[model samples]
Target: CLGVAIFKKKDSVEGTREVYKDQRGRILVVEFIYGGMNFRLINIYVPNIEVDRREILEELKGLVVGKCIIVGDFNIKCSRLDVGKGVKVRWEKSRGIGMLMEIMREKGLLDVWRYENPEKREFTRRQLKEGTLKQRLHDKSHAIFNAHLVSKAVL
Candidate 1:
């Protein structure tokens, strides 16, 4: 299961900051919980396609929380290396995704995946052969910003 919630105040945060579950029934939330010592966790699902992912980024910038560990599938993509290949007809329709990337940059949302895996590989759409959702470019099909997490605090 996935969850999305926004809180205004900073000091008002406490236990179970945000409640959510996973495929194996694990309770998840956003808060400062250090691993066996000190840390925090913040899970988010920035809207894509229809809504702007920047809103969430702005909200994060507005808040002054401690040791945040945000993790979620921010449905977005910028280049073909992120996904695979895309069709020009469908590529033109993914303007929202481009905006989401901009928002992420403006809000200082670092791509943890990119940092963790610098080799540059596609994580989703393994089934798409070579003519599904990509344009007729050299590398533009897997251009979706899917399955990733952005965070300011380390885990």
Candidate 2:
């Protein structure tokens, strides 16, 4: 089971509301008032398995409307660059990834880190209970935010 939440300064937010959540606890989305506009924070735990991951993404696509961000593992590599040095095994030749990219394109949600540092190859390494895998992209979480929404909430 996965859980997601956002902790913000008390005064900086208002009108907190939950937008969506999955039965398996895979996704959690909430809306709140910030900078005088409503913004959504979406967090998800994408399964490593390809088929399951794709199903979650499909259900999530419809919810990708308006002033929101979708953040999750997506369990995929957006491009070859997302794979680290000597990590060709990490590349997933899956259509689920393409669908995810399409969803992002339609909603204008950009992976914050990727958008900012296009030329840099960065990886966050850690040890899960199962084990540690170097140069793996899925373990790292993504913060996908609408570019327009980010710029407007500059308070």
Candidate 3:
């Protein structure tokens, strides 16, 4: 199941509220004020199916219009670098990655981790087949840290 969660307590940060969400329940965007500026936090869980992922990207790529940080399990690799060593490349993988990179570029988003650590690789896990990609997908500029894949952009 796809899910997005943001926890708020009575003492939690003020000026935080949900702004947008996809009817499909795959995306939930929240706006919050920090350092006297407003920014959006886009939480997403992209479907594994190629067709479904494409549909989500059609909507998600537009979310970078303002200052925002997007995070989630995209299920798709961002590039050849995202694929594990010797993994058999497939049409779906290539298609998905190209679409993702295209969206990032056209939207002026930056891949945070790739920009900072160009050669860095995830050290926690490895895959013998298919792929294991945890990309920090971003569009404009800023910063957000997370255990799951994450990225930031500023407009």
The CA lDDT of each predicted structure is 0.46, 0.62, 0.63
Candidate 1 per-residue lDDT over residues 42-149, each given as its tens digit: 545556435344555454444424444454545554554554434232556654566555545554555665666555665533444575454221122222343333
Candidate 1 error regions (>4 Å): 1-29, 35-38, 52-57, 86-109, 127-155
Candidate 2 segments exceeding 4 Å error = 89-92, 126-133, 137-155
Off by over 4 Å in 3: 8-12, 90-93, 123-155
For every model shown, what is its TM-score relative to the native structure? 0.50, 0.76, 0.72
Order the candidate numbers by TM-score, best to worst: 2, 3, 1
lDDT of 2 by residue, 5-92 (tens): 5566777788988888888888888888777877777777677777788888788777766577665555566766666565554335
* TM-score of model 2 vs. true structure: 0.76
Cα RMSD, each candidate: 8.7, 4.6, 5.5
Evaluate residue 55 in candidate 1 and report its C-alpha lDDT on the 0 to 100 scale. 54
Error of 2 at 133 (Å): 6.8
